[model samples]
Target: MYNKTIITIIRGALGMTDCKRLMEERRSVNFFDAAQPLTPELLRQIVELASLAPSAFNLQPWRLIAVRSPEGRERLWRLAQQQPKVLEAPVTLIVVGDRGAWQGDNPAWGELAAMLGGAEAVKPYLAMAEALYGATTERRIKFAESNAALLAMSVVYAARCFGVEGHFMSGIDFAGIKQAFALDEDEEVVMLLALGYAEGGKVLYPRRKRQSYDELVEEV
Candidate 1:
């Protein structure tokens, strides 16, 4: 007998599976206990898992900067509107989308082509990515931002599986973050995530009401 409910609960706790119950259970966590730091290995695991998020043409056009060092975190804090959560959390991820992925000097083209059967097969895909996302400056940035947004959500859920919580935010000096982080001109910061463990056990806020299926879905 497969107890899916119980299984989901356990797997969700481990951050191994994406279940609706788990998604519903997670809330924006603030006030992380900085004393309870996340190990480097654990942080790596979470990022690697989240990197599996699908992207257009397998470009995976996002760059992640995990500010774990004290000095780095301090620099990031200054750019992030001096948010207390940014300083209190053990790690803060500067998630950005690189619009340069489709342009020249891009390595993803070679990598994706290798998987699908070498350069010949992937040439068209490379062209398509460029044509669609590289049509104009606005289109390029928006397409890149949309793809990176997917990775951001994946990261939030992946953190939950490791008993870690996150608070995703966008209120910041965008230019400051890029300057502090040395982000290239073609790269745009999508969001920042403060990651750490809660001081007490299970400090989940009450689940908020969401749009009903009827309101959310449409039967065509």
Candidate 2:
């Protein structure tokens, strides 16, 4: 298990106000300043921060294809229903989820073993992951997509922390993306994230109304 004290300390440094502001300010930017491309170093930093997102058995199943090159972006734009944001954003990430990440060969298994004491300590976890995520083809896909979605949300928030904006787009050519990107059979495309500086550092429209907490929550 993770150290609660350490987690609390990190949260304290982040502060509740900062967290609230990030949640409130983040928007799906439709217009990106194409002239201001994301630097490789900045992109790396954002991804590294996003990777801290939690996952089942810590078997980080996510993969990303950063489409920054002109050719890559153009190809992705075509595969993504030609969304203008795909071409306008400085970088677009093809988020993929590996359904086979629960396998024993995954490096996360070894890392978890080391954290828990020894390789023997990971046996139960391995069995649990297999039983939960490997039951059927649909289950495997669910495991991958669910975990990748968490990482995708983290990427959006992490980018916002650095003054970068992001948009999550599911309108895509799934089969074409898989074929064009040459993904493995077990790798499922989760979504695409377009990231860049928003045009004029603002959104064209005001924030839309969201469901109230009372309307969304349920007491069971």
Candidate 3:
């Protein structure tokens, strides 16, 4: 069950006006307040909120390694191209995607089946997942990466609701991270997220120009 305090906090922070303001003001913070500490309880709450992100067949396949200790962050810093934020942020999350989550034997399938009605009701969905994601290696990788990306995005936004800032980093030594972390072969490293308060309570640069809707959108 979701925590009532967390639900209240989210409700207060995510009102229409606040939501729009948060979206516009959010930035990929480059400088983190190293002195400011993030409690494990708060971090867990952020992750719990992020878990609400959607996934195909309700098979949520993402995993996270929260590198919070100074030593752990130092190790992550090396793997992440020596990015200072990896160390400066109170926590860095190694987001992983399970490429084999769609398999029939996955426990999530059984749980989903129970929720839907029964095994019989879930058979078609299982077949569809297999047909869409299991036919080729490329398809399975795409499915994992895409769904994990969705979860990662949610993590960023969820952190913001608690006045935390986050930066997404993809320029990392993926192979080294996998080996160092001892990840399973089926787990794909999606991205790294640095989470903490911004140094001096704000970002350094003004918001950059974004493409206009007309340039970015197409009416088919």
Best by lDDT: 2
For candidate 3, the clash count comes to 0
lDDT of 2 by residue, 164-203 (tens): 9999999999889999999999898899999999999554
- Per-model TM-score, in order, reads 0.85, 0.92, 0.90
Question: Model 3: per-residue lDDT, tens digit, 76-179?
Answer: 89999999999899999999998998988888889877776789877887899899988899999998999999999999999999999999999999999998
Model 3 pairs whose backbones collide: none
* lDDT scores of the candidates, listed in order: 0.84, 0.92, 0.90
Ordering by TM-score: 2, 3, 1
Badly placed stretches (over 4 Å) of model 1 are 1-18, 201-205
Which run of 10 residues does model 3 get worst, by summed lDDT? Answer: 1-10
TM-score between candidate 1 and the true structure: 0.85
Best by TM-score: 2
Query: Which lDDT tens digits does candidate 1 get at residues 87-173?
Result: 889999999998878864578777766666777877776677778999899988887899999998998889888888888889988
After superposition on all C-alphas, the RMSD of every candidate to the true structure, in Å, is 6.9, 2.4, 5.4
lDDT of 2 at 164: 97
Positional deviation of residue 61's Cα in model 1 after best superposition, in angstroms: 0.4
Two-way lDDT contest, 1 vs 2, winner = 2
